[model samples]
Target: MAITSANQLELLQTAEAVAREKMIDPELVVEAMEESLARAAKSRYGSELDIRVSIDRKTGKATFTRVRTVVDEVENHFTELTVEEAKPFKEDAAVGDELIDEVPPVEMGRIAAQSAKQVILQKVREAERDRQFEEFQDRAGTIINGVVKREEYGNVIVDIGRGEGVLRRNEKIGRESYRPNDRIRCYIKDVRRETRGPQIFLSRTAPEFMAELFKMEVPEIYDGIIEIKAVARDPGSRAKIAVISYDSSIDPVGACVGMRGSRVQAVVNELQGEKIDIIPWNEDAPTFLVNALQPAEVTKVVLDEEAERIEVVVPDEQLSLAIGRRGQNVRLASQLTGLDIDILTEEEESARRQAEFAERTKIFMDTLDLDEFFAQLLVSEGFTSLEEVAYVEQDELLVIDGVDEATAQELQARARDYLDEQNKLALEKAKELGVEQSLIDFEGLTPQMLVALGEDGVKTLDDFATCADWELAGGWTTVNGERVKDDGVLESFDVSLEEAQNMVMTARLQLGWVTIEELEAKAAADAEAVAESIAEAEEAGA
Candidate 1:
C-alpha cells in the first residue's frame, strides 16, 4: 500500500528516527516542527498572519496554508485581509482568527522550497532544544555525560547530546581541567534555550555532583540500601553528606565507607582530593544535633522547640573543635540540620545556666506562674537552679523578651514554694543551698504612695523601675508630663535634675498620662496628708 518514491512517504519515519536517536518522542518532535514552521512563517510575513501545517500519516505529504488577518486598511498584504475580501472562508474567523489561503504547488518555487527547508530545520532544532530544556531543567543537581568542546570566557563548553552545555568558571572544580574532545561527566545544573540553541548547563560545583559520582561507584546507593538526604559542600575543598537508611540493620555511614572506604575514596579522588565527612542522619533532634556537629562529641543539647533553636554543649576539650575555626563547624552544622545551632563549651554552659537561673528568680518575684515556653526560655537562658533565680538582678533578667513583671512574680512565688519543699526534704540541702529571698525594695516609695494613685495603678517593674536611675535620690518615682523633672517625688527625694528629667520620659515604654511626674505628685500629696494628721494630733494633744 506504501509507495517507494515517498521520501514523502518515509518523512514520518525519518522524523521519528531523528526524535528517537535524540531520545525525544515522535509526537513531541511533530509538535516542535509545527511550532517552528508556524514561527518562521510569522517572522517572514507578519505576526498578524497565521500559517498552519499538516502531515499525512500514509504518505508523509505535508501542506502549509497562509492565514491573513482581516483589517480595513491593509498595509501588509501578507497579513491584513480586507473585511469584504475575507468574508468567504473568513466567516467564523474573527479579528484574531486567520483567513487561511492554500498555496498552489507552482507558488512554492525552488527558492520557496529552499526557504521551507530552512524553516523546518530551524524549527526542528528549536523543538529539540525545548524538549531538551524540559527534560534537563528538573534534572539540575544530577550527573550527566558530555564531551568537552572548547573553552570560552574562561569556561568550558561541553557538548551534551542534543544541546551545547556550558560549564561556567565558578562551576568548574578547582584545578580540574579538561581539553577539547575530552569526554567528561558533570552535574546538570540548569537547561535552557536561546538563539544559540539548547544549553544543557553542566556543573562540577553542585553538591549532588559528588553524590551522583558516589552513586555510580557505590552499589548500595544504587540498590537503595543507603539514601542521601542532604549535602553541603565547600566545593573542591571539602564536602559533607547527611545520609540515612530504611533498615536499622544497615548503617548509612558504614555502607558509604565501603569495605575499607574504597567506594568513598574513589569519589574523593574524582573530586580532585576533596575531604568528605560521612555523618549519620538522625531523627532524634538531640542525636541529630550531636551528629551534625561531627568530629566533636556533644555533651548536651538544649532545645528551644518553639523557636527552632538548639544549643549544643561540648566538653572543654571539644569546644574549639566543635565550633571549628571561626565558627565553621557550627555554621555548617546549622546549614545541615536546618536549625539555628548555638555551640557552647562546658564552662559557657555552666555560666549560661547560672545566668538563666537569675532570670527566672527575678521573673518569679515580679510575675507568678511558669508557662512551658517561659520555662524553655529559662532553659535557653542557662538557668539550672531555682536558688540562682531568687537572687537574680533586674538588669540581667530584663534582656529576655517575655519576662515581664507578672511573669517575674509568678517565678518568684514558685521559687519560694520550691525552696520550702526542698528545705523540708533536706535541711542539709537547704543549709548547703541557702534559700535566697529578697523583698523588692521600691527604692523609698512606701505602700502609701501606691494607694494614693487613682485608677492609674502600679502593676509592673516599669511602674517601679521607671524610677529614673539618674535621680540619685528617690521618694516615690516621679515623672514629668513628658519629662521626669516635674515629679513631686523628685524634690522630696532631692534627685538630680538629670534623674528627674529622665523619669519624666520613662524611656523604654513611656506612659503618656501617668508619667514619673504624676506619680511623684501623688506621692507628695500623700506625704503632706500624713504630715497634716501628725500635726493635728499634736495640736489636739496640746
Candidate 2:
C-alpha cells in the first residue's frame, strides 16, 4: 500500500468512519493513523531516525518528516547532530534547535501494513475504553435501565446502552432470575477502569437502589422537600428507610407511603417485594431507633454514646415481636441507627438492674468494712464506686438520710485509705512486671493504667508511644456486617481515645521524637484544610 494523492483522502475517510462507528473523537482516530503511519515509515527508513507524520484535518493530506536535534556534543548519531553538521539542513542552525527534512511516504509491504493495522485497532480500542470510563464514572451511585445480555457463571451481563455491566450473583435479589433480553433496572454501584475495559458494576440488592427507587416515585424526595436520611435492607425480604421532611407541613413517612400506598408499593415491587418500613427521622438517636423498630413498642432506650451501643427494653410479650424472626428486626434497626442494639424484655432489664445494684452494694460493703444495711444506704444515695465516695463533697454525703457529719467523715477517710492502699499495690505490681521509671513518671497515666500497660508488655515510655490510640482505648470494628469489640489496655480506667492520643503525643515530645514546630505546623495545616472545606461547602450552598 502506497500513500499517494489518491490514497491521502482515503486515510482521512477511513479515520472518520472508524471514529463515527466507535463513538469516539475523530481527532483521536486521525492521531492514531498518524502514529501507525510513522511506525511504518520508521521501518522503511533507519529505525534509529526520529520519523514523524502529520495529517491535515481539512485537506486530508499526510506529511512525513525526519527530525534531528542540533546539540553541542552529539551522542545519538541519527537523532542528534552538531551545529556545524546541521548547517546543510539550516544555514543558521544553533545548538538545541530541531532540524526537519521532508521525506517521502513509505510504500508499506504486507508485514508493515499488517503491523500498522494492529496498532490502529489497539489505539481505537483504548480510546473506546477511555470514552466508556468517562461516560459512566459520573453515573456511579445512580440507577440505569439495561437489557440482560447473558449470564456467565451466576453473574448477569447487561447491555447498559454504551457499555456492559456485571451484576454479581450476590448483588441480585434472592431467587430472582432473568432471561436474556429481559429488561431490568439496577443501581450503578461502581465504574472502574481495568486492563480489559471499563467495568460497570450493577446492583439490585444495594440499599441505595431502594432509596433511589423512592426518589423516582416520590416527588418530594426528588424536589428536596423530603430527604432519605438512611436505608438498611435485607434484600428481597425486609428493609427500613428513615426520612426527614424539610417542609413542616409535609409528613415524611406519609409522603413516602403516598395515597393508598401507591408510591412505596412501586419501590417494593421493583425490589422483588422487599417490604419497606418508612420511618420518620429524628435528630435524637434513641428516638430514631424507636421509629426504626416499627410495630414493636419500646418501653425504654438507653444509649452508650462512646461505645455506639443501645439497650432497648420492651414488654415481655413484645420481646419476640421486637426481635422478629432470627433477630432480623433488631438487626435492621441497628443498621439504620448505626448502633449495636441489645433488645431485652422488661423482666430481663429489671433482673439485670437488681443484679448490678447487689454487685455495687457488695463492693462497698467489702471495701469500706460497712454492714450490709449501711452499704445499701450508700448505694441508694447514688454512690456507685469507692472513688465517688472517696472524693465526693462532704455536703453530698451529709444529705443522705441518717448520715451525720461524723459518719460522712469516717466514710470518706476509709474510702481514701482503701484507694491509697490499692494504688500502692498497683504500682508495686507494675514495677514487678518490668515497668520502667520513665513510664511511671509519665503524666496522664494512673497506677492501675500503668499496671495494665505493663501486663500487656508495654513496659517503657517508648513502647507506650508506639501504641495506637485504639490500643489504649477500645474501639469497635465491623466484620461481616457485625460490630466486634476490641479490648483496650486501659479501657478499665476509662481512658478516652482523645486522651490516649494526647498522652502518646506528649510521650513522643518528651523523647524529642517530634518537635513543637512540627506539631504546630500540622495543626495549622489541618485548620487550613477544614477552613477550605467550609468555604467550598458554603460556595456550593450558594
Candidate 3:
C-alpha cells in the first residue's frame, strides 16, 4: 500500500467508518492509524531511527518525519546529535532541542501491512473497551432489558445494548432457563474493567432487583411518596419487603399491594412467581419485626438492641407458619429487620420463663441463705442478682409480701455480706492470676470482671486498653448466613458493649495513650456528622 495522493483521503474515510462502527471518537481511530503508519515507516527506514507520523484530520494527508534530539553526549547515534553536529538542521541548536526533517512515507509490503493492520485493530479494540466501560460504569445498580445471547457452563450471557452482561447461575432465580434471543430483565449488579473487556454482572435474585421492580410498578415509590426501607429475598421461593410512607394519607402497604394485588403481582410474575409479603415499616424495630412476621400472631416481642437480636413468642399453632417451610419465613424476616431472630412458641416461652424464675430463686436461696418460699418471694419481686438485693433500696425489699422493715434490713445485710465475700474471693483469684493494682484501681470494672480479664491473660492495664469492645462484651457473628455466638471475657458480668468501650477508652487515657482533648474533638466531630445526617434525612423526608 502506497501513501499516494489518491489513498491519502481514503485513510481519513476508513478512520471515520471504523470509529462510527465502534462508537468511539474519530480522533482515537486517527491516532491509532498514525501509530501504525509510524511503525511501518520505522521498518522501511532503520529500526534505530526515531520515525514519526501525523495525519491531517480533514484532508487525511500523511506526514513522516525523522526526529533527532540535540544532546551533549550522543550515545544513540541515529536519534541524538551533539550541538556542534546539528548546525545544518538549525542555527542555534541547544543540548535539549529536537531537529525534525521531512521524510517520504513508507511503501508498506504485505507483511508490513498485515502487522500495521493488527496494531490498528488492537488499538481500536482497546478504545472500544474503554468506551463500553465508561458507558456502563454509571449504569450499575439499575435495571436493564437485554436479549439472551447464549449459555456457557450454566451461565447466561445477555446482549445488554452496547455491552454484554453475564448472569451467573447463582445469580439466577431457581430453575430459570433461557434460549437464544429471549428477552430478559436483569439488575446491573456490578461493572468491572478487566483484561478481557468490561464485565457487567447481571442478577435476577438480588433483593435490590425486587425493590427496583416495585419502583417501576408502583408510582408512589418512584415519586418518593413511599420508600422501600428493606427487602429480603429467597430468590424464586419467597420474599419480604418493608416500606414506609411519608404522607400520612398514603398507606405504604396498600399502595404496594395495588388494587386487587396488581402491582405486587407484576413484580412476582417477573420473579418467576416468587411470593412476596409487603409489610409496613416502623421506626420501632420490634414493631417492624412483628410486621415482618405477618400471618403469624406474635404473642410477645423482646428485642436486645445492643446485640441486634430479637426473641418472638408466637402461638404454638402458628409456630410452623412463623418459621415457614424450612425456616424461610423467619430467615427472610431476620434479614428484612437486620436482626437475629429466635422464634419460640407460647408454651416454650412460658416454660423458659418458669425455668429462669426457678434459677433465680435457687440463686437467692443459696447466696442469701433464705428458705425456698422466701427465695421465691425475692425472685418474684424482681431481684435477679445478689448485687440488686445488696445495693437496692431497703424499701424495695420491704415491699415484698410479709416482709417488714426489720426483715428487709436483715435481708439486705445478709445479701451485702455474701456479695462482699464473693468479691473478696474474686479479687484474691484475680490477684493470684497476676492481676495488677493498676487495673484494680482503674475503676469501671468489678472484681468479677477483673477475675475474668486475668483469666483471659489481660493482667495489665496495657492489655485492657488493647482489648476490643467485642472481646469484653459478647456479640454474634454471621458465618455462612447463620449467627454464631461469641463469648466475651467479661460477658458474664453483664458488661454492655458501650460500657466496655468506655472502660477501654478510659484505660487508654489513664495510660497516656490518648489525650482528653483528642477524645473530646473526636466526639464533637462525630456529633456534628450525626447532626448533619439527621438534617439531611429530615430534608429528604420533607
Please name the candidate that would achieve the greatest lDDT relative to the true structure.
2
Q: How many clashing pairs per prediction, in order? A: 33, 0, 0
Model 3 worst lDDT run, 10 consecutive residues: 440-449
lDDT of 2 by residue, 162-271 (tens): 99999999999987999999999999999999999999999999999998999999999999999999999999999999999999999999999999999999998898
Sort the predicted structures by lDDT, highest score first.
2, 3, 1
In model 3, where do residues sit more than 4 Å from their true spots?
478-482, 521-542
- Runs in model 1 deviating more than 4 A are 1-104, 107-114, 135-141, 193-196, 356-542
Residue lDDT tens for model 3, 1-542: 99999989999999999999999998999999999999999999989999999999888899999999999898999999999999877888898999999998889999989999999999999999999999999999899999999999999999998989999999999878999999999999999999999999999999999999999999999999999999999999999999999999999999999999999999989999999999999999999999999888898999988778899999999999999999999999999999989999999999999999999999988888889999999888888888888889888888888999998888889988988898999999999999999998888888888898998999999999999999999888889978788999988878898899999999999899999999999999999999999999999878
Q: How high is each candidate's TM-score?
A: 0.55, 0.92, 0.94
Give the per-residue lDDT digits (tens) of candidate 1, residues 1-542. 22135456566786788777777667665665555445555555556655766666666666667767777577887667777777786566555556667642223445545665676666666666777778778777678888899999889998877667889999988888889999888888776766776566688888778789878987778788888877877777777789998788988888888888898998988788988888888888878878878899988888965346788889999988888877777876876776778877889889987786667656543443565567667656766566656667645566678778776765666776766664455433322333211102333333323332211333344554454443323323225522122244334434454564454444332435456677688779999999999999999745
lDDT of 3: 0.93
Q: Give the Cα error of residue 242 in candidate 1, in Å.
A: 2.0
The global C-alpha lDDT for each of the candidates, from Candidate 1 onward, is: 0.67, 0.94, 0.93
- Tell me the alpha-carbon RMSD of every candidate: 20.5, 2.6, 2.3
